[model samples]
Target: MAGLSRPLETELTFPVRTYDIDFAGIVSNIVYVRWLEDLRVRMLERFYPIEPLLARGEGPLLARTEIEYLRPVRFGSTVRGIMWAAGHGRAVFDLQADFEVAGETVARARQRGVFVHYGRMQVMPLPKELRSQMESAPASSRQQGG
Candidate 1:
């Protein structure tokens, strides 16, 4: 574990739009879901692109999602979200994210997903390429320890 590189984290930012707020002037719960979806898409786009997976007729599907609001996000606030592939099993891949406003945590979310064969509707194992990328350090970020 000491020698293994940390998992790749994908960070993104979102502004609290007027449409994202509720009558109470706080971000709606559904908006968090949308942001989570965006995080997942960006994660894929940054790492293993979705185009190839879709072309192969296999792609990840969200099996479950859980989000906890720690603080209210008001309008004019920008949320910074950082997500990473927490871990994976034979078929299930887990992702974790934290949304922070001005360096303070506003919410935390987790997503459980699985890859499936489109036509057959069968589960597929996690791709080695993805696993390796997540486990290896980024070339630019890798630094020798003293």
Candidate 2:
């Protein structure tokens, strides 16, 4: 979340739904988790389709999430979320994401997790195709934040 940031690879816009509002009349913190899920799915689809992963009984498992809320987001406001892959290890992968309103960041988050074989309940290496995509990309364009 602090070291580096890069161009967004998967960007999506969302309407701040009524149900997202808290008693304080602002978007609740829990809503950000939903948005993060959406962002992650989009990122996966862009680099590696979920269908293939699921077919192989492989899926990502989130181990942790850290969010920094920078500003209040109110209901009815439009939010633009940008997600990118930050780094990878033998099995763990890092993701960074930000929520923007009118070009200003309202929140940012970092997620660290790994892909696992569902039936075996074991960790799997980052998909080769997805890893190749990142390796073949220019540094500036490599999926950097999710």
Q: Provide the overall lDDT of each model, using Cα atoms, as 2-decimal numbers.
A: 0.81, 0.81
Show pairs that collide, candidate 1: none
Please write out the lDDT profile of model 1 over residues 6-125, one tens digit for every residue: 465788899999999999999999999999999889889878987888999999889899999999999999999888777766667778889999889999998888888989999888
Tens-digit per-residue lDDT, 1-146, candidate 2: 24323432678899999999999999999999999999988777766888978998999999999999999999879999988777666677777888999989999999888889999999888788777655633455333433
Q: For candidate 1, which ten residues in a row score worst on lDDT?
A: 137-146
Model 2 scores worst on lDDT over the 10 consecutive residues at 136-145
Residue pairs with backbone overlap in model 2: 83-146, 84-145, 84-146, 96-146
Candidate 1 error regions (>4 Å): 1-6, 136-146
